[model samples]
Target: MKKIFIISVLSLMLAVSVFSASKKKYGKEITVKETTKISEIIANPEKFEGKRVLVKGPIVDVCKERGCWIKIGSDKEFESIRFKVEDGVIVFPLDIKGMTAAAEGIVSVKKYSVEELIKSGEEHAKKEGTTFDASTVKEPKIVLQIKGEGARVDGK
Candidate 1:
C-alpha cells in the first residue's frame, strides 16, 4: 500500500509541473517604440551602453528561480543576450518563456565574478532540480543585460 501511495504522489507532482509549464502569463502592456534591431545593438554595444532601448523578441530562457531575468534574442535560433530587472523593482513570471516580449531598459555590459557565476549556476540548478558543476564556469564573463524600466508580453 505504501508503494502504491508513493507512485501516486510522484505522478501528481509530475502532473502539477506539466500544468504549470503549459500556462502562460502575460504582463502589463506599456507603450514602447522598438526602433532598433537587437543585432545592431549587440554588434555595437558601446554605442548603446547606458542608453534605454526597446527590443522585441521571443524569450529564449526565463530565470526559473525568480523570473528576474530573461535571455531574449531577435530570432529564436540566433539570439544571445540577457535582460534582467533591477532587484526588487520588477519580478517577471517564469511562464513568460516562448512568448514574444518588448522590453525597454538601459543596456549595459554587466560583469560577473567567477564565484558569483557559480552561485547563480547553483541557484538555477536547484530551481530546475538539476545538477550544476560550478567548475564549468571557468572565468569571469561580461553579460549584456537590460536594466528594465517598463515592458510587456504579447498575447499568446
Candidate 2:
C-alpha cells in the first residue's frame, strides 16, 4: 500500500511539471488585454477587422507537418481564426493542442477564388491529415485569420 501511494504521488508531481512545461514550450510572452471569442470576431468581422486584439483559448489544431500555424478557439466548431507568424519568426509546436494561449495580431480577411480555395484546402488537408472536399466551395471564400506578431502561452 505504501509503495502504491508513493507511486501515485510521484505520478501526480510529474503530471504537474509536464503541464506547466508544455505551455512554456509553445510561444513567447506578450502583453495582451482580455480574451476575445472567435465567435465574436466571426459575428461582426468588420469591427475587429484590420485591428489588433487579444484572443485566448485552447489549441484545437496545429500544423503537424510544421510548427507554422495554430487554431485557437473554444471548441472544434468555433475554431475560426488561424494564427500564424512569419517564416522562421515564431513556430508553434505540433503538440500544442488543448494548451491555453493568447495571441495578439491584426484580424485579416483574405478573399480567394474557388480554385484558390480548393488548392489551399488540399494543402491544409495534406498537412493536417484530414479530408477536404474542394468542390463544396464553389464561390469565392472570405477567410478570417489572425497574423500574430506576438503570443503568450499560459504556463497553466
Candidate 3:
C-alpha cells in the first residue's frame, strides 16, 4: 500500500508538470498582431504602446554600447525605425548588419535625441556594472521601435 501511494503521487506530479509545460508553450505560440506604420508609430506611440508588433526592414545599424536597438527603414522616403530590444531577451548579432529581418515585439514610439540616446547607453552600461567604455556608442535615426519577449530571425 505504501509503494502504491508513492507511485500515485509521483505520477500525479508528473502529469501536472507536463500540463503546465504545455500551457506555457501554447501561451507563447499565440501570435498577437500590433503592426503600425513608421510615421504613425512615431507620431502616436501611445496607440501601440506596450503592444507586440511585427516589423520588417533592413538592419541599418546596431547599438554599439549594447545591442539594445536596431535601426530599420520606414515606408516613407529617407526615413528609418529605431527598435529597442526587450528586457532580458537575447541580443541579435551584428553580423546581420545589412540583411533584412522580420521581428516581433512591443512597440514604443518616443522622441530620443542623440544626447539622450548616448546618455541612455551610458546608464545601461552603468546598470550592468561592468567595466565597459561608453564613448564608442553610436545613435541611429529611429523610426519604428518594437520590443517583446521572443524574436526569431527570419530568412536573410
Model number with the top TM-score: 2
What lDDT would candidate 3 get against the real structure?
A: 0.63
TM-score for all models, in order of appearance:
0.65, 0.72, 0.51
User: Candidate 3 has which clashing residue pairs, if any?
Assistant: 80-143, 81-143, 81-144, 82-143, 106-147
- In order, the Cα lDDT scores of the candidates are 0.76, 0.77, 0.63
lDDT of 1 by residue, 1-156 (tens): 999999999999999999776444323344566556788777778888998888888887887667788888774357667878865567777777887877877888878999999999998788789999987999997777777776767654
RMSD of each: 10.4, 7.4, 8.1
Candidate 3: regions farther than 4 A off: 1-30, 33-35, 86-88, 109-144
Candidate order by decreasing lDDT = 2, 1, 3
Worst 10-residue lDDT window for candidate 3 reads 21-30
lDDT of 3 by residue, 1-156 (tens): 999999999999999999765431211232646545666666667787877777666778877655666777776768677767653354656665676655666776566676776777778768778654556655643434675444444346
Sort the predicted structures by TM-score, highest score first.
2, 1, 3
Candidate 2, 16-67: lDDT as tens digits:
9999766554345565667678788877788888888888787777776567
Error of 1 at 94 (Å): 3.5
Give the per-residue Cα lDDT of candidate 2 at 68.
81
